[model samples]
Target: MKTILITGATSGIGKATAVAMAKHGHRLIICGRRTAVLDTLKEQLSSITEVFSLTFDVSCLQEVEAAINSLPEHWRTIDVLINNAGNAHGLEPLSEGNTADWDAMMDGNVKGLLYVSKMIIPGMKERTSGHIVNISSVAARQTYAFGVVYCASKKAVDAISEGMRLELTEFGIKVTNIQPGAVETDFSMVRFKGDEERARSVYAGYEALKAEDVAHAISYCVHAPAHVMISDLTIYPSAQSEPRTIYRKQ
Candidate 1:
């Protein structure tokens, strides 16, 4: 079984992917900022496969470096790295946006992914075989009012994924970007800054995608034949055609 390391594995797509991968008997290193949630998830998944948990804020380069460095020698050679830890902070027009929120988005979504990848990539280079899956968003393709930074952040992920693929091709490393639209996770809630009503309304009239759907896709990407690499994929709910066009049953 290949060893997999997933960032932000405490909840949503990350957590679901961890569980799905564990069921396939892969060794897992689940990373998150929440210690309690990490411990709980590790205990739960350990029964299915070898499981280790690391708690660190991916946005913090020092923490990301230290956490990966702290892994045992055996776990350091991760077969797959899932860059899945990210969140949108607030919704407001560009002129009205908060700088703090912008920082959070840039740091968490873009810089954080880079930081983790930087730490794990050398090991993969030495092995000359590994897969990197980056969880992007439909926002990367379509931008809406009040979502400029979030969209930009995801766009950066797309660029990074392609660049990494080109740079790592000689080493036989594969990079895949999964761009998911409107999944009903805590994503909306967090973006609304804890406004549950607002978050609920966003998915009220449509059958939004679920975490498990994305998880299944991720697992599929990881398990594909060695010669086949699904470079980029975009998934949306049946009722949604794009980020701005959702056919809601009103």
Candidate 2:
């Protein structure tokens, strides 16, 4: 059983991955900004495997550093780090995009992943064993009219994942980037800035991917043999062909 640390464990893909890994008998270090939700998840998954939840805003470098640095000696040896804490703040044309939304995307999606990885990588190097799973998006592969910033952020993730794999090769640390298309999660709600109707409309008339589907993909990557590594993977729904093309029966 591996010791896995998952960020954004309070909901969606992160939460599903945490539960799936727990069932596989792996110890979980769940990190999120919401303490109550994290505690609740810990209670739910603790029956299957050991769970340790840390509350910190990943966008804050100081918080990321302090939280990981303060982990008890045992928990510090994280065998897997899942960078899953990211969201789309708003969907808008680049000319009309909100500055705050742009900052949130860059800070949380790009900088936050870097900060958390920076804190966790040294131990992996020392041990010469670890896996890093970065949850990017289909947006990274193609650009859409109103998804400029979100696409840019995920593109950065893709690049960083590749860079990390190259730099960590000598140390035997594996980096995997998972790009997912149109999963039915709080993502649309957040992207539409809490407009529930708008969010629902995005997933209507189609069978979108579920959080569990992505979780299962992550589990597959994690369970691979030590000598084998799944470098990069992209999962899309049957109804969706790419980031901008989806067939809706309605």
Candidate 3:
């Protein structure tokens, strides 16, 4: 069976992707900061596929490296890596944004991705085969008020994905970037710093993209033939015209 490694597997896109992959008979090595969540997920999936869980904060470089190194021999040779651990800290204008929020976004979204990829890419290189799926956002392409840092982080992800594609093409490591518009998840709640009401207001107008929607896109990328690599996939709800535009009915 194919082996898949997914970061941020506790919730949102990552969790959805893990479930989708398990349905396809892929052995999963999942990483999350919460051991409880990872353990629970392991239990839930134990009957369907072989699952290995690692608990570590992706934002910490030391933690990421150590956790990956500590993986059992059975989970080391990863055929696919989903770098999906990321966050949007606050929805305040950049001029008055919280430094803490900015740091959270930077560390979790950009550095975290790098740390995990660094540990796993070597194996893919040695095997001369692999696929890296990066979960970017529409914010990566379009900036909005209070979204500067989060946008920048994902922008960095977009750039990194391109750089990986260019550099790893020779190694036959396919890099896929999936940039989803809006999803009804804790993403907004995190951005609003636990202000559920504020977060809910952002999605009042229309049916935003769901976590499963992005998961389907990721599943497609993983199932594609080795020779076929989807460089980037940008998906938006039909009522959504852009990253900042949404049409909500009354």
Candidate 4:
């Protein structure tokens, strides 16, 4: 069984992926900011396969380094790395956007991904066999109103995944960029800064993708033959035509 490392594993897509991968009998290193939740996840998944948890905020480089460095040497030889830790703090016009929100998005979505990759890539390079799956969003393809910064962050993910693929291909490392459309997760709640009504409204009209749907797609990519690399995948609900186009039955 391959050993995989997943960031933001406490909830949402990350948690669902951890479950999916564990079912495939792969050993897992689940990393996130919540120790309690990580511990609970580890406990739950341990029944399926080997499991470990690392608590750290990906936005902090020091924490990322320390946590990964602390892994037992065995777990360090990660066969797959899933860069799924990211955030969208607020949705507002540029003129009214919060600089702090911009910083959070850039730091976590862009730089946080880089920091974790920096730690894991060297090992993958040495082994000359590994896969990196970056979780991006449809926003990378189309920028909607009041989502400029968030979209920009996801676009950066698109660029980073391409760069990783180009540089790591010769080393036998595969990089896949997964751009998923609207999924019913805590994403909207966080984006709306805990506005329960607003968060619920995002999916009120139409069915949205679930975390398990995206996780299953990721599982498929990672389980492909060694000679095959499913490079980029974008998934949307049947009712959603594009990042901004969703059909709602009134």
Candidate 5:
């Protein structure tokens, strides 16, 4: 069975992807910050597939290294790494934004991705065979006024995917960037800092993509033949072409 590692696997897209991958019979290493939640997922998926869960703050680089070092000896050579641990915070214009929010966004969305990828790459490089999927946002492609920092972070992810692809291709490491638009998840809840009413409003009037949609897409990308790389994919809700261009019901 193929082995896959997923960060941010406690909720939303990452959680959905974990469930989907487990159902497909892939051995999985699930990582997230919440130990309780990760343990619950581990319990739930254990009957379905071979799985291990790790709890660590991906934003903290050292924690990532420690967690990897602590992995079971038998599960170290992972076949795939899904860099999905990220968050968006504070929907406000740059001039009025809080520095803490900016830092959180930068740390989680960009630096967290790098830290996790760095920990996994050496193994993939030695074997010269691995698949890496970085979860990005439509924000990576188009900037929104109030989403400047979040958008910039995802844009960095976009660039990282491309750069890694170029650098690792000869080594037979495959990298794919998945840029999804308006996914209905706790993303807005995190962005709005627990404002459930506001988070719900973002998707109230339109049919938006769900976490499972991205999960299915992720499954498809990874399940492809060894020689074929999906490379990049952009998915959007039918009701929105851009973040600020959503057509909501009147």
Candidate 6:
């Protein structure tokens, strides 16, 4: 069983992926900002397999470095690193966008990912074996009105994934970029700034992808045969065709 480290493990896809990996009988290192939540999750997963949880804000480079460095020697050789901690704050037209929202998105989605990866990648390079799963979004593929900044952040993720694959392939490292569309999670709630009605309406009319669906996809990528690399995967719900085109019932 592989030793997998997943960030943003307190909720949504990250939390789901942690459970999925545990079921695969793999060792797990879960990271998130919420200490109590992380402890609770660690307790839950301990029943299944070996589990370690790190509490740190990925956006803080120092925190990211310190947390990963604090891992036990055995857990440091992470076979899989899932960069799943990211956010989409305040959907609004570019001209009307909140600068604070823009900063939060860029810092958390782009730099935070880089920070965590920077800490863990060296060991993988030395071992010449690893898989990195980056959780991008369908927004990376298509630009929707009022969500330009958020889309841009994910676009950076796509680019970063490609770059890592190109550079790390020779070391036998696999980098997979997962772009999931309209997953029913706290995403819309966060994006809508805690407006329950707005967040609820985002998924009201049709079947949206569940967090587990994306976790399942992640599991598929990491569990592939030794010679197989599921490089890029984009998942959409049956009722949705793309980022901007979703069929809503009357």
Every model's TM-score: 0.99, 0.99, 0.98, 0.99, 0.98, 0.99
Winner of 3 and 6 under lDDT: 6
lDDT of each: 0.95, 0.94, 0.91, 0.97, 0.94, 0.95
TM-score of 4: 0.99
TM-score of 1: 0.99
- Model 6 residue 9 lDDT? 96
Across 37-111, the per-residue lDDT of candidate 5 in tens digits comes to 999999999998999999999999889999999998999989999999999888778889999999988999899
Candidate 5: Cα lDDT at 115:
95
Give the per-residue lDDT of model 6 (tens digit) for 73-142: 8888899999999999997788898999999999999999999999988989999999999999999999
True-structure Cα RMSD, model 1: 0.6
Model 3 local distance difference test score: 0.91
lDDT for 84 (candidate 3): 96
Worst lDDT 10-window in candidate 3: 88-97
**Full-model lDDT, candidate 6:** 0.95
- Put down candidate 1 lDDT per residue, 158-232, tens digits, no spaces: 999999999998999999999999899999899998999999999999899999999999999999999999999
1 or 4, which is superior by lDDT?
Answer: 4
- What are the per-residue Cα lDDT tens digits for candidate 3 across 59-88? 999998899999888779999999999998
lDDT of prediction 2: 0.94
| The 10-residue segment with the lowest total lDDT in model 6 | 88-97
Cα displacement (Å) at residue 239, model 6 = 0.7
Candidate 6: give its CA RMSD in angstroms: 0.7
Clashing pairs in 1: none
CA displacement after TM-score superposition, residue 80 of candidate 3 (Å): 0.4
| Positional deviation of residue 190's Cα in model 1 after best superposition, in angstroms | 0.5
